[model samples]
Target: FYIHYIASTLKILHEEGYIYRDLKALRASCAQPVYFSPFVKASNVLLVEGRPVLIDFGMCKNISKTGRTYSVCGTYHAMAPEVRALSGLDHDTRAATTSGYGYPVDFWGLGILLVELLTGKPPFGYRNGDIGDLFELSRGSPSTIHWAAGFEPSRDLRDLVESLLQPDPSKRLADWNATLNHPYFAGITDDMLPPEWDSDLGTEL
Candidate 1:
């Protein structure tokens, strides 16, 4: 249920030409799978009426017109490899070059969140809770899941996670439309989605 909600949220954001750089457990608010949240880490998520909702927008980025951004921001463990790669360069270098990222970064973060939801830990080992270690791990290689005893996930689900976590953003799932069409969401259709899920918020940002 949370997967569907998150996918829908991503769909909405994509239609609006924005990228939600932050995706993590604390960034979601849910009551039996009604999810919403905004920007950054755990502290930004809040509960409303027993449902998790994203409450912070401080780090949200509007990329509708340009379809990309180069800001090296977002939590370490949840960042896409390209986003983490930017950390080694100075801001001036980033601004002077065409190197940056786009919506795929959010999908990478969502992949991390999905792993955490299933296994109670990020796909990459937490690296003793060190931010630098986490970034290094994220930038190194794609993660392989090792489920706890008797907690194995379905093959389709695992495939979905792996696809989203692809190190190459270009090769990652191509936005929410492609995501919702995956086998993991086999039976879900546009008719079942909420009205807001289809509304185009436009490229005003």
Candidate 2:
């Protein structure tokens, strides 16, 4: 259900030329005590209506074919490895290669969102309970991300999530339409998707 919802949301968001750089559960709430992100510990997810919504604008940016943005923004736990490297906060803390990173970051975040939706936690979430620790876990082997007990998501969903979590920005989802057509959303249809109220919200940049 979340994969379908996110795919639809991203479809509309990308169609409107916006990149949701910091997509996370925290962003789902309009108001909350703790900041939205995997590392920011908080309980009680209050659902507005029947569907969850993505909030926060501190890190989103405009999508461009040739535009490059550099900023240390977004929830660290939900950030793409490329964004983390660019921010100089990862374990390596080395300067990035200075390439343009935009839509790819959001796609990576979408992958994390899918994982959290299925398992009630993000793939890199660990006992460390800090942004840096989450990022470190993300840097570890792929097998580290596994579904917890009582969950049996299909392999297609898992594969799609893995594709989204790929570290290389160049290999992320091409567009929302492409994502919608992916195998993960096999039987999902437009009727099953939710509507976007913020359809006209411009890019943060």
Best by lDDT: 1
For model 1, what is the alpha-carbon lDDT of residue 125?
A: 53
lDDT tens digits, residue span 132-158, model 1: 444444443455444545668788988
lDDT by residue (35-87, candidate 2, tens digit) is 23334343433233335456566666666555567776776677777777776
**lDDT of candidate 2 vs native?**
0.62
lDDT of 2 at 173: 64
Q: After TM-score superposition, what is the CA distance of residue 77 in candidate 1 from its true location, in Å?
A: 0.8
Q: After superposition, how far is residue 194 of candidate 2 from its true place, in Å?
A: 9.5
What's each prediction's TM-score? Answer: 0.72, 0.72
Query: Least accurate stretch of 10 residues (summed lDDT) in model 1?
Result: 89-98
